[model samples]
Target: MKKRFVSMLCIIAFLFVSICGRIAYIVFSNDFTVSESYNSYVLNLETLYPVIYYYNLEKLTDNRDKYAAVLRPNERTLTDLHNLFPSSQINEITNELKAGYPLVKYVDESKIGNEKYIKTFRMSDYECVQSQLISKASSGLLSYVEPCGKREMRFHIDALGRMLRGDEGEEFEESLSNIKGIRLTLDKKVEEIAYSALSDMQNGCVVIMDVKTSSILTCISKPDKSYLNKAFSQYNVGSVFKIIVAACALENDIEFYYNCSGKTTVGDTEFSCQKNHNHGFENLSDALSNSCNCYFVNLAQKLGSKKLLATADKLGFNDDIKLYDEWSFKTANLPNKEELSSKGELSLFGFGQGKLTVSPLQMCYSLCTIGNMGVKNQVRLVYSSLDENANEDIVKYKASTRVLSEETSKELLNMLRNVVENGTGKSAEDSYHKSSGKTATAQTGRYILGTEILNTWFAGVYPSENPEYAIVVMKENGKSGNEDCAPIYREIVEKLNYL
Candidate 1:
């Protein structure tokens, strides 16, 4: 009996020792990880950045009135969760919550914990305005959570939150809080106007810029689902290229008069005007107003490839416009002299055809140069950044350069006004503001039902006398610029007049 009792005591002591060792291993081992559900974390909200469009009188402003927030799953039943998220999304939501993670960021917080609600990806109005920008500026920090749980979590994150989290790097580490929030030149009101105008289009874009500052006010791209911003994507520029041709003619002092007999031929290639309509006895101004293709072709021959391309280069052709770090406008392209060796190719190039392509943002800036009386300001989208203390770190851009003579720009502006007053761009006339612009119906070389598809465009400036705003509107697979795009420009301008 005494031997049995001693053996039992030894066995119990060994079991106690084993259990303590196992617990110690689980607590101290690097290879072991607690379930996220049981673990808590201090999400450094300061690490997550906020993006702003405007504040006070500053162009790129960040007051932090609006910040990034996440949707935290409250104490809701499983059935309520199912109703709040779709059947497909419910599982993901539940899994994320079970893992003690946020459901998603930048969600509408007012609707949280609503059991009767159906699943919708509803965001706050401010979030809707700056969602794209926030996604770019956050750099995945918004989704990252620390594995600490000493303090309660806050859903809203901004620069102030960063200050409270305390700096945890080298003592000399630069505090970029003044540049904390990504500041953009985009105007929310103007953005809404542009968006509403293109909402019905299958695929298109609208770009608006301040002529003097070259700040982008509104940029809207259709098919809202596309990751590509169509405003920065290149498309074949039609008659709008005429603006460049006209500049070349005026700057080089090239003058000519051409009688269009519906079509012109060069190197066995027959080029016809729109619907082959004959433009009789036209000079530079008349040709521009009528959008006469024959006149430009003749003009191109006179200027030749060297002079024409020189002017195009001066106007920022074959260049990528860098709006922000790593974010840029797709480079605009033009054929080199070797490619335009023949008169036929040159003729096509003259009328904004052949291998010429430009992004709508670039097109808008080209007009803005003219509106600024030949000064080309660097196109800007991001204005600056705000730090934790709401201090601003303004982004310096390249200085404006004179790309065209003031005299030539003034003449071109008048010609553009004539286009809106009595030419193809008549549909873009704004009653409240004197608008000037050029229209183009570019052939895409794609045939649908045996009809050549066209990319229509209308690029213009508002209050033409002293241009303040330059706007470009583009539509894919359209019938005519005046019919499809110019009207949209007019609507945008008229609405802007109220603002």
Candidate 2:
């Protein structure tokens, strides 16, 4: 009896401790959720971009593929002689047409004498709207080879699922009602152009978009059909993100002038410029053009975390972009004020380090707003979904929010132009057209023998005065943005000039 009483007492004490720990956790955590592990943010292996599609429609020609085959595979062969005669008492009728017993019979009207069935074959004979579905039932928008099947009546979808021809066949209403094509914002010509350039790349993505509209013209993820779109996948963006920090600085009217001794320390955390050498004294535009780390870090510390976060929020960071429940191009993470309590952390955040991660798409969009004279259009992937009839049921999705002011836009545009003219991103310049851009070589922390792995990046806008396009290129583990990514950007710019 004494032992039993002791056991009961211990159980009661254990329950009390558990309840107290839960309360303490809730109180101190302040209901802020620590984000999920890094791997959880990735899309699934088999997940295809459901919104990937093209806008234009071409009419499919009435030409049918001609072929020749002796008979359908299901029909009994001539070797099955027992079932040859339909009226034979010794055997039963086979499911398929008996081979030996020809169905040909004398008829009053004969074009090629007596014939049982047509001799030549055409794909149209075996193909119907239902059979056309046999090929594309598995893949959504990923396949470039397997074409969408024909509706038989008149309309036939092309290989890429773009509606080539539309005219309701005899069953136009029924066929149209059955067909649903998800329209994507991808331009066929632009996609082709981007592909031809990046085709040989082992891995990476090439993204181009309409700066004014924020509509992606081409988004081709490399490794051809990778489940994760590296173009939109978030990574430490390095100094390419300086544009955002710079914008924030300008918006807050922070002093753009500072002296750089090449290295500075914040609470024992030393930060150095790229070359570990002094840049002397410089203004904001010079710092941006030179890609000075010390200048930005000092600016970030002075601005404080609250103001920086506000700037990031205004520019769209640490936000949810609900593209799908399990799949999406999510916004990148930003440091909270509490985490920025230390000068080191704030400085790191200022220079695009310390847990900062962002998709190329997000960066492109931010630059688009700068190019769009501070107007930010919602990133649109799809124009609308349509049924076969071509009837009007357009799902219009478009909205614009001013992301920056016109004055800031003008100043920033000029600063970007300076970058191409006399900055780390000089390769982005062109002889004929004005260009503006930023280059970055982000440290990945995973080093070997004291050498660092990197994520190189380049973000640019062409025809700077009145920008038409936003272009971005990235290379994983590529050492320098200028050496690796900038040349690729130049090639793309030259190609665009041809157009």
Candidate 3:
């Protein structure tokens, strides 16, 4: 009997310990309960969009200054930034959230009675904005917070008691380039600006047109001091001038198979490759691809300055081509007869490193000329005249004139295409699109007494079988054209691929 009693006592002890452990668990679980409450509040907060529901204490019907906080609105404004929301007025938007306001049918606020406030919202505009934001956010293009130069197009206003437009007065003034219809309003927001010709660059513009129909696509420039259509005013063409050297060589009957012994001594001066290492023996195609100064200088000695100057002038280097707006670009200080007589300087001109100055737009024109198989077009920045009705009237059908033999143009193009595929410009390969181009690293700034820094470049045309577009990219003080400019060109081409 005593043994049976002891066994029962042991069972009773186990039961007591289990109950105490259950109590301890309940006591330690305060964090879990608080977390659940916080998550539930967050879920409720996300549903508010077009309409914000908050406190409305007026309906308490109690004879007290503050009637016990019972008549609270379901929502309140989270931020006072009116520049982020362009569509809503504070009072009108939040009115439905007031106590005793009629609830919309699409949204369910039935959980809270008429006396209590429940936030709910639905709007087509809000849906559209949300969809666009979500789509762009995943692509790493949109940000929840504004980055520098990227301002929110919408906002919320607290001081005005309504949603107000963000003040864009300073930006509109500063952003004024070759842009049209940009006017500052009394309210400080930009009233309107034609989007076609707007440019962020300090001075930049583009004039694109369809040749057959003479349909103008875009004419844009900014900083009103400059015009889009003129090519007489000088800008650094940088290494883009290499296209001229390539043309001069072929025009002078330089064979693509001819070889350069890498280094050539002219008088007492020695001109060598940027690598300083010898290319040993390379053909004309490789010389052009590798941008060999010795090979081009040797060839330029044969072509002489007269032929090179004539070729550049014929290709529209000397003349000013006007784009839309008042902008103009022109070639700078061409080598004279005396300078061209020196073998070293003449060779430098062939490689586009010394004394040969042109504009970025001009270089683009030369590339287009080559792509058009020696037909140089009268470069048009604006293809039509804008009427009073804002309709574009066709004014010009710029036809291309023969600049070089078609065979010569094709030969040079094949050599450039091969460069992109196998030589110095191999990095410029567009996996998303097929392109043909060449890289150039022209010395622009003096690094030491004799040596100079390079301005890298990559110029090309796309869809090689039947070309449609040509582009040039230049990076100042870059180490190599293949390294710096080619990647930028690749990105620009990829962006243009879908368009």
The candidate scoring highest on TM-score is 1
Model 1 Cα shift for residue 402 (angstroms): 1.1
Ranking under TM-score, best-scoring first? 1, 2, 3
List ranges where model 2 is wrong by over 4 Å. Answer: 1-53, 58-179, 322-329, 448-450
**Which candidate model has the greater lDDT, 1 or 3?**
1
Tell me how far the alpha carbon of residue 194 in candidate 1 is from the true structure, in angstroms, after superposition: 2.0
Worst 10-residue stretch by lDDT in candidate 1?
163-172
Candidate 1 clash pair list: 41-148, 42-148, 177-387, 177-388, 178-386, 178-387, 179-385, 179-386, 179-387, 180-386
Off by over 4 Å in 3: 1-240, 256-261, 324-327, 397-399, 447-452
Ranking by lDDT: 1, 2, 3
* C-alpha-based local distance difference test score of model 2: 0.65
Residue range 162-190, candidate 3, lDDT tens digits:
22222111111112112111110011011
lDDT of 1 by residue, 308-380 (tens): 9998887777667776666554558888899888888899999999988888988888888889999988888
- TM-score, model 1 to reference: 0.76
Residue-level error in angstroms, candidate 2, position 75: 10
With candidate 1 superimposed using the best TM-score fit, by how many Å does residue 291's alpha carbon deviate from the native? 0.5
Worst 10 residues of 3 by lDDT: 182-191
TM-score for candidate 3: 0.54
What global local distance difference test value does model 1 have? Answer: 0.73
- List model 2 lDDT by residue over 49-117, tens digit each: 122236664211212343322222122322333222234521333334343222211112212222233
Report residue 443 deviation for candidate 2 (angstroms). 0.7
